[model samples]
Target: MSRVSRRRFLEDSLIAAAIAATWAPSRAESEGSLGRKVGPNERINIAVLGVHGRGLDHVKSFAKMKDVAVVAIVDPDSNCFEKAVKAVEELGKPTPKTVQDLRRILDDKDIDAVSIATPNHWHALAAIWAMQAGKDVYVEKPVSHNVLEGRRMVEAARKYKRICQTGTQIRSAVGSREAIKFIHEGGIGTVYLARGLCYKRRDSIGKLPDGPVPQGVDYDIWLGPAPKRPFNPNRFHYNWHWNWDYGNGDIGNQGIHQMDVARWALKKNKLPNSVISLGGRFGYEDDGQTPNTQLAFMDYGDAQLIFEVRGLPTPDLLGVKIGNIIYGSEGYVAFTSYSTAVVFDSKGQKVKEFDGGGDHYRNFIDAMRSRKESDLTADIEEGHLSSALCHIANISYRLGSPQPFNPRTKAFGDDKEAYETIGRFEKHLAENGINLNEATYRLGPKLVLDPEKESFVGSAEANALLTREYRKPFVVPDKV
Candidate 1:
C-alpha cells in the first residue's frame, strides 16, 4: 500500500500557503466586468459544478439570488445541461455556458465563485483547484473522501484566504440554529450526549455485470481522485456512495450533517480522544462495499457522540429518524429537520418548539461579498471536523476486530461491550433475514487519537486508510 510521504505534504502546503497572497483572482479577471470594478452592488458571477444531481439545485439557487449570476454550468455528462439551463431560464436568468470539463471552467477569470455538488470523491480536489485558481467555493457534505483530504481542503481555504462553504445547510437553518442556541444557554443544562441518526431507507443495489462506458460520459474525468477500475453502475452516480473508492457510504453521505450538529452541541471543535465502530452491510449481497447498517462511537472525555446509520427499515431513535437528539442534565432537544426542532423535559414531555429557516447559499454569498470567512454559515473548518469523524469510524471498521477496551482508560483492551454491540448488530441483520454465520460483523478497535494531530495512536495500518492513492492530474495534492 502506498503511504503519503511527509515530503509531499510539505511540498503541497508550501505552494498553497502562498497562493492566496500571489494568486488571488482580481475583478479584472471576470469575463463580464459589469462595466466597472465589482462593488457592493455588482453581481457575482459563479459556476455550478456537477449538475447531474445536487448541482441542479445549486444552479437554480444562485440564479434566484440578488446580485448573483450563474455564468457557467459544469458537468462531466453533457445531457445534464439541458435541464440545468432550463432551470436557469425559467428563473428569468440568462443561460450559462455549459461545459463538461471543470478545469476548463477554472481557467476563466470572470468567474467569482463555484458551487460544487460532485460525488464525494471529487469534492476536495475541486474545491482546492477552484481556490488555487482564485475562486471562492461552495462544496457539498463530507467535503472530502478521506480524513487527510478534508484537512487539506481546510488548509487551501485558509492559506488562500478564500471563502469556501461546506454544504451542511443545517448550520444556517434557523430552526437548528435556535435549538442549538437554546442548549448553549443552559436550556438543556450542560449537554452530555448527542446521538445522530441516519436511518434513511436504502435497498440493495444487487449485483450487476460490468458494462461499457455510457456515451457522452468522460469516464476518466468522472473517476478523478479515485483509482481507475472497471466501469459498473453500482460504482457510478448516486450508487457510488456504497463504494470506498468514491464515497463514505451513508454516514459520510447523510450522517455527517447530523454528526456536525452533534459535535456542535457538545461545543467541541477538534477530533475526539478516541473512536470505534461496529456493524455490517445487512439485508442482501450486492456490489456495494460499504456497510448499510453501522454504528460509530466517539469519546470526548466529558461527553460522548453516537451515530447510527440503518439502511434497512427501523424505528426512529427518540422519535426522530435522520436527525439529531442532544441529551443534557435538564432536558433533551430533537433536531428533527433542517427547519424544525423540539425541546422536551426530563420526563420526555414536549416543552418547547422551534421553527426557522435560512438559505446557506445566500450565507456564502454574504461572506464572499464581505471578504470575511468568518461570515460563512458552515465554514470549511466545521465541515472538516465532522467529515473526519466519518473517516475515523470507517478506518476502525476496515481494520478492526472484536476486542475489549479498558474501562478506566477507555482504550481497547477488553471486549464484552464490543461483543455485545456486535451481537445486537448481528441480531439486527438477522431480523432482516441476513445470516451472520455466513458473514459476521466487523468490529473496529478503540483507536486512541491525538485530537490535535488527527492520527491513530500507534496504528500505522489504521492511519494509512486516512488517505488514498490519487490518480494523476486529478490528485488531491498532499501539500494543498
Candidate 2:
C-alpha cells in the first residue's frame, strides 16, 4: 500500500478499536420515502457524531423528533459520550448505543441519516463519507473547513442524491425566511450591501502543557485529517473553535450564520469578484490561532457584502444585536440572530417585520419526513457559501503582515487599532493579575483576494494555509 493508504488504515484501525464494543445493528424502521407511511410508528434511525459542544443539542433535538430515532452517538471524548448516553436515557427511550468512531455508525445499514456536529475540520469528511455510505446528512454550519472542501461536499450530495442539510438552523426561523423573502421581493429595494456582525469578547485558552493523550480519548481519531500536534487542552475542547488546525475561528464558528443570510438575501451563489480583509488577534495572550477582529469585503457585480467579526465576545458590537442588516436604496431591515426580523423604509419608518418561530431542528425533521429538499430552509450549499465568506476573510487577513513591534520601546508602530487591540488585551491581563505592559501584537498586512478562487491572488503561503494537510486514512475523496 502507498504511504497515504497505510496511514488511512492505521487511522481507521484506531477508530474501529475505539468503538468496537458499542457498534450495533441498524434500527431504521422508516419507509422508502419520507412522506410515505412505512409504518404506523416508523422512526428514522439516525447516528450522531461529535457529541460534545453542539452535539448535545443535536442529540436532544433528535430525541424530541417523533419520527427520528437516534440509535448511535459517536465522540472520541469519553466525557461527551457518557453525558450523551445519560441524556438519551433521561429521554425515557432506549439507550442510544455510544461509539467513539464515526465509521462504526456509518457501517450500520440501519441508519437512515447521520447528524454530524464535529469540529470544523471534520465536518466535510464526515458528511462526504456518510453520503458515500448511503446515508442522508445533517451537518453543522460552515459545511466544510475550506472552500474546496465545501464544493466537494456539494458535489457529493448531488452525486449521491442525498438529502444533505447544513446546520444554519437560523435559516429555518420564520422571521429570517420571511425577511429574506421581503428583501427578494424588493422590500429592501435593491440592497447593495449586507453587513454581518459577530462581535463578542472571548478570554484566552490559557497556556496548557502539552502531554500524553487523555484516558479514554482517541487522540488520533480526534485529530482526524488535521495535522498531528501535541495534545494541548486549549486546542482540544471548545477552545478549538479559535484555532486554525481544527477550527475556523469566530468567522466560521458564528459569523457564517449571518453570511448565509446575506448571500441568501442577495441570491448569489457563485464566488465574488474580489475580496480584501484585515484583522488580527487583538486582545489577550491566548492560544487562539485566529483573529480577534476581522473585516472582509466581497464585490458582486453591482453590489458588495461586508463581514465583520469581533472576538471580544462581550459588549455588543451593534448595540447588543449581532445579525445581518440589509442596506438598500430605499430602506433597510435588521434580522436578529435568532429572534425576529424588523424592517424600516429609507425614512427609518417601520414597514414590516417578522417575529420568528423557534426550532430549526424541528424544521429539519419536518423536511426529512416530507422528502423534499426545499423543506430544509438552509441547505448545505447555503452554509458552505456563508462559511466560505469567513474563510476568505481569514485568508486575506493572514496574507497581510504582522504589525511591526519595538521590543526596546514596548510600543506598536503608530497603528490606530493596533494599539487599541493591545490595550484590550492588557486590560484583561491586569484584571487577571498579569503584567503585559510589553507584549508584541503581530497583525497581518492588508491582502487582496480573488473570491472566484477563494484564495489569495498574490501570496503562496497564505493560500497554502487555506486547505489542511489531511492525515492519512482520514482523506476526503475527490469525486468530481
Candidate 3:
C-alpha cells in the first residue's frame, strides 16, 4: 500500500478506538432537545478563532450550551479583540481568555475544542493545527481554500483522533434532514439533476487606489498563506467574500450551502466526470476577480447537477424564486434559504412541504459528547465534497474560453469559432448591463484539467494558482 493510504488506514483505526473509548450518552439522542445534562456542567473548554463576522455567532451559540464554555477568543485584528472581550464580559461569566495570536490559543493544553470562523484561506490550516493539538474543531464552510488543503484537514483529523465538524449549519436543521430524506426515498423519483442558485445584489468594492495599511489590522499576518497585495478596504471585511485571493466568490460563500444540500440529497462523495462553466462579472464594475454571474454544469454519468450564481440583480431568475430545485423523474423538491422545502410532481402539484429549523451548534456539542461523528448531520467530509464541487466549477470557468452565445442557435461558440464565441460572451454581458466597451476584460482561455492530480493538463499559469506561496515563518508546511 502507498504511504498515504497506509497512514490513512492507521489513522482511521485510531479514531475508531477513540470514539469507542470516549462514548457518552447524549440527551438529544433520546430526549429530543439538548438540555441540561447530568453531572457538574461537564462543560467543554473552548476557544474561538476569527471572532469577527460569523465568529460572534459561534460564541453566542456555544455560550448557551450547557456543556460548552467559551475559554478564549482569538483574532489578528485588534478591533475584533475588543468586540470579543465585551461579548464574553456580557455573558455573566468570568473573563475566560483573550489573545491576538491563534498559535497561543492552540498551544494552551486546557482548550478542549475550537471554533474557527476565519477567512477561507485560513480554514484548513487552523483546523489541521487544532486537531494536531488534540482539540476538536468546528470550522466554517468552504472548509478549504483549495482542494488539497481539505484533504489534508481530513487526514489530520483522523490522525489525531479529533471530532471535527464543518459549519454547514443547515444540515442540522430538522426540516433540511426531512427534505433530503424525502427526496432520497423517491419523493423526487429518480433524481436526475439538482440545481442551486444565489441571486443576491452586491455593490462595487470601491475604486480606491490601493495603498497603506489600516490601523489596528495586521495586514501582513492576514495575508499569511496568500500572495501579498496592496491593502484595500474593499478587499477586507465582508468584501473579502468577493476576492479570488481570499474568497471563492458567491459559489463558495453562499452557493456552497445549497450545493451541500443538493449533494447530500444525491449522496455524492466525489466530483462529476465532466464539467462546463460560463459567465462573468455582468452588472457592477467591481474589484472582484471572480464572476458576478456564472453557471456551471457537472456531469455525473447517470445524472447531472447545475450550479448557478447571479451576483447581479437578475429579475425573474429561477422562476422568481431564489433557492435550490431537485428535478427528478416524477417530481421536484424546492428549498428556500428560509429553510422552507416543498415537493411538487410533474403536474406541478404540491405534495409535501416542510420547514427545517434548529440550532446547529447544539447538534455539534451533542455529537462531541457522544463521540459519534455520524451524529453530525453535516460531517467534514461531506462539506469538503460540496465545497470541492464549487471549486471545480470556478477552476473550469477560469480555464474556459470567453464564449458568447449565438441567438439563432441559442448556444455558445468559443474561440475555435472566434467570431461567434466572442459575440455570445459580449451579448450576454451587455444583456446583463456589463460594458465590455468601457474596458478590457481579463479573460482566461480554456485548458484541460486533471482533478485527480489536482493540476492543469497543459497550462502553466493555471497550475500555478492551485497552491499559494506562503509567507516566511507563517507558512503551512507541505507535509505535516
Candidate 4:
C-alpha cells in the first residue's frame, strides 16, 4: 500500500468521484459488457447476507427485479433468516434457501452475486470472500471495518475482475445527480466547502450484563474477526452501530451518506491533508463507547469539509439535519433527503429544486449484465474511499486532546473556524443542559497526513490505526 503513489490513487479513483458528482458516464464505461453476457431474459441469482435491518431491504429489492432471483439468505441468527425468508415470500418471489452461515452460500456455484449488509466488522471480509468464491458483490456503505480493509476490498474486486457496487444509493437518485450537475455547471459558482449535518438524538444504551447466546444463533460466526467477547444486547442488532468494535459510531452509521456527498461535490479522490475532531458522548451514560456528539474537520488543501454529529435531541441547523449543506461562492445546495435536492442562492432564496427516483439495485443489475463497473452507481472504490473517511475521523477522535489549530496554514497554529465550530458545538450542548468539565474534552492534534501513502506524518500512533490485527481464518489478508 505504501508503494502506491498519490497520483495513481487519485487517477484511479477520480472516475467514481466524477461519476458520482456529475452523472457523466465515460464512453468505455457506457458500452462495456460484463465478460459473460447475460441475455435480457437471463436470471441473476443473488444471496442476501446479514438478513436483518438493511439486509431485508436487499431481499425485497432484488426479488422485485425482473430476471433477478434471491437464491439464498445468510445470517448468524436463524431468526433473521426467518424474517428475510418471509420478506422474500411476501414479495411474491420463490422461497430462497436459509442458512445460519455464509460459507454454505459461498460454496454454491449457482450464486451470481452476494448482497452484503453485514455488521461493519463483517462487511469487507464477507465481500472479499464472496468475490474469492467467484461471485460478484453489492456491499453496503462504508465497505470496510478499517481503512486497510477498504483498500483490500478494492484490490480484491480488481484482482478477481468481479463487478462490485457500493450501497450509497444517493448516487442513483436522479435529484442528487442533477443537483451535483448543477453545482459543477457554475450554478453554485466556485464550491469551496461542504457541511454534513447529523443532528438526531440517541438515548443511553444503559448498561447490560453479558448474557447467554440466543438459541439457534451461531455466535462464533457472528463474532468472526472481531475480538472474542460475551454476547450482550448492546453489542448486537441495531445497537451495534454505537459500539466501536462493530460500528463506526453515528458518523459512520448515518453520517457516511453525507460524507460521500461532500466528497463528491468537491471531486475529492485522495483524502484530506489534515484532520482534527473535538467532542464526546455526552447527554447520558450508557454502554456505548463511541461519541454521541462529534465535530470533524478535514482540510483538503483548497477546500474543507465539516461533519457534525449530535445524538442528543436537537433542532435542525438552518432547517437542515441529517443532510448535506454544500456551500459555493455564489450559492449552495441542500440535499434534504434521499430523493430531494433544494438549491439556494447567496441571499438565502430558493433558486432550484430537483426530485429523485432511481433504483441502485437496478443500476447494479444493469452493470452486471454490461460487465462494466462504471455503469453501476457507487462502485467498490467509491465505497472504500468514502468509508475510509469515517475510519479516519474515528482515529482522530480516538487520539484527540485539546490543542490549538489553524485553518489558514492547514496545521496546528492559531485557532480559526475549527475552534469556532467546536465552540458553537459546546454552546449547543449547554443549551440542552449538557455540560462537560472542559478539561476532559479532547481536541485532536493537527496531524499531517500524506494522501498518496494514506498515512499520518511523524505519528506512529495515528499510522498504526490505518489497519488492525485480524483473527485467524476471519482475517482480512493484507494482499486481499
Candidate number with greatest TM-score: 4
For model 4, the run of ten residues with the poorest summed lDDT: 24-33
Per-prediction TM-score: 0.88, 0.83, 0.83, 0.89
lDDT of 4 by residue, 43-131 (tens): 99999999879998899899987789998998888877777888878878889997766766665767889999999999998988777
Model 1 spans > 4 angstroms off: 1-37, 402-427, 435-439
Across 132-225, the per-residue lDDT of candidate 2 in tens digits comes to: 7667889998898887798788877776667788888777777777888888899878888877777666666767788888866878889999
Report lDDT (CA) for all predictions.
Answer: 0.83, 0.74, 0.72, 0.82
lDDT of 3: 0.72
By lDDT, the best candidate is: 1
Local accuracy of candidate 3 as per-residue lDDT tens digits, 1-480 = 789967965774465345434433233322222222323457688888888799998887787665677889887676787777677668765576766557666556567889999999888877876776667889999998877677777776665656789998888788877888888888868988887777666666756678787655667657767787898887888788888888998889988888888777777777676565667776666678887777776667677677767665555333524678888999888887647788888988988887969887887787778767888877788877888878877777777665434332223243133333345446555776665556344333444556566556676866665666766555555654
Ranking by lDDT: 1, 4, 2, 3
Model 1 Cα lDDT, one tens digit per residue, 274-358: 9988777777789998988888888898888888888997777678898999989998999888779999999999999999999
The per-prediction tally of clashing pairs is: 10, 13, 6, 6
On lDDT, who's better, 1 or 3?
1
| Model 3 backbone overlap count | 6
Tell me the lDDT of candidate 1.
Answer: 0.83
Mark the 10 consecutive residues where model 2 has the least summed lDDT.
29-38
Query: Which residue ranges in model 3 land beyond 4 Å of their true spot?
Result: 1-41, 316-321, 407-465
RMSD of candidates 1 onward, in order: 8.2, 7.2, 10.8, 11.0
